[model samples]
Each structure stands twice: as C-alpha cells, then as structure tokens.
Target: MLIYANRDAVEAWSREEAPDNVDVLIRRASAMVGVATRMARYEVTPAGLPADDDQADAMRDAVCAQVTVWDKAGIDPTAVETEGRVSKTSMDGASFEYDRAAELSERTRVASTLCEESYDLLRLAGLIGGRPWQR
Candidate 1:
C-alpha cells in the first residue's frame, strides 16, 4: 500500500528531524491510516489517494500526525521482536514488574493504531465514518 505521507511531510508535520527509522515509520503509519480510513468514503485518483485536493491533504496530514505521535512516544513500530517471555512470574519472591514498554509497542505494532489527531483530521475531511465507506 502507498504511504499517505512522505518523509518531508513528516518532518514538516513535527518541525523536527525524523529518526533513522523514519521510512518504516511512514509505512507503518500508512498501514494504520489505511485501516482507520477503511470506513471512509471518498473519490480517489488512480494513485489511490483522495481526488479532492483538500481531502488528499487531510489524509497526508493524518498520516504525518500518526507518525509524529508514535515518534514522540519512543515506540518504534519496526522493531524486531524476540521470543515471547513470561510477562509475570512468581516464586518465593513475588515479581509484579513486567515489560511495560513492550505493552506500549504492542499498541503501535498493529496496523490498527490511530492517534487522536489523525482521527480528527480524517473525520473532519469526511474520510471516516461517513457515507457508504466504499473502500
């Protein structure tokens, strides 16, 4: 699937230099946007972007906003995972501490991830939860 926002747009969105993992971040953000916007209905170009200029811009902005939010949270969606380990274990000594960071990444790991700002932008553009939502 095509990424809704480009590297330059992501930088411009946050007014900061993107991290080295930016390319993967963009792809991940786009996937999430695709799922979120699946319920949206809009005219599309041959490239699969919204036909209207404003709607297209909104899509791009929403993707960029998702990237910005994920970056700020220090969650790298492209990170490789290791074998699953016991999240909670107890013996003579009780250990309640678990991998909280991993939990945060879990939310970002899926294509369903959607930031609040991104949702708002898509909703405002009528690209979500409106009309017939025809792909």
Candidate 2:
C-alpha cells in the first residue's frame, strides 16, 4: 500500500499528538486516500501508490487538518454518530435550533475547502479521470 501521508506529516501539521490515537489518524488518512483516489479515477496499488505527489500532499494535508480539528473538539471524525443539536430562544420568543447533522462547522468547512482545492489542482494536472475498473 502507498501511504502518501504519515504520522510525521500529520504531527508536523497539527503540532499535537495523543500517542494512542495513531489508529484514528490512520483511519482518517486512509479515508483521504480513498476519496482522493476516487476523485482522480485511480486505483491505489503498490505500483501506483501516489499517482500524483502534489495531489497526495494536498489531500493528506486537508485530511490531517480536519482530523486535528476533530481531535481538539473531542469528536471522532470517523465515528458514525450524531453530533446532537442545540436550540436557543430569544427574549422576543423567537427560537432557533442548530442541527449538527445538517450543518458543517467552520473548521470542517475549511478542511473541505482544502480537499476541493486539491481536487481542482489534480484536475488541472490531467490526473483527475481514469477509472481502474474501466480497463
């Protein structure tokens, strides 16, 4: 398997570590690879682990940044669970509720932007479309 990103890169980017959360980091990194590969229409094989180094770096950075934010928020990005909701009522009786499942956090949005930028870069590089199964 081609690990385009590593613990060192993530640590360097986030400047924090749990020493015990390596598995979680690995899961997030793997997810980044899966999504990036799918977007690039490529298969992640030993021979072609990193179809493009720049794309891989961008994807890894995005995932790592998101993972870091999640860690700071005490949430597991890979966990399949509800983030719950918060409701607030104004003095005038107006009420509002924020839906966690339906909304993205600012940090999360930033991470998504990074990933999108990475995809865009790859697309411009002509590395964005080649389905392995098409062969």
- All models: lDDT? 0.77, 0.54
Write the residue-wise lDDT of candidate 2 on 1-135 in tens digits. Answer: 344556777688778764457556556655654555564554344665555666566556655655565556555555434455576666677777666745545434433322444444445555554432231
Clashing residue pairs, candidate 2?
Answer: none
Please state the error at residue 121 of candidate 2 in Å. Answer: 7.6
Give stretches of model 2 more than 4 Å off.
1-3, 41-47, 83-135
Which 10 consecutive positions of candidate 1 have the poorest summed lDDT? 104-113
36-74 per-residue lDDT for model 1 (tens digits): 777667888998888999888988998899888778877
Q: What TM-score would candidate 2 get against the native?
A: 0.50
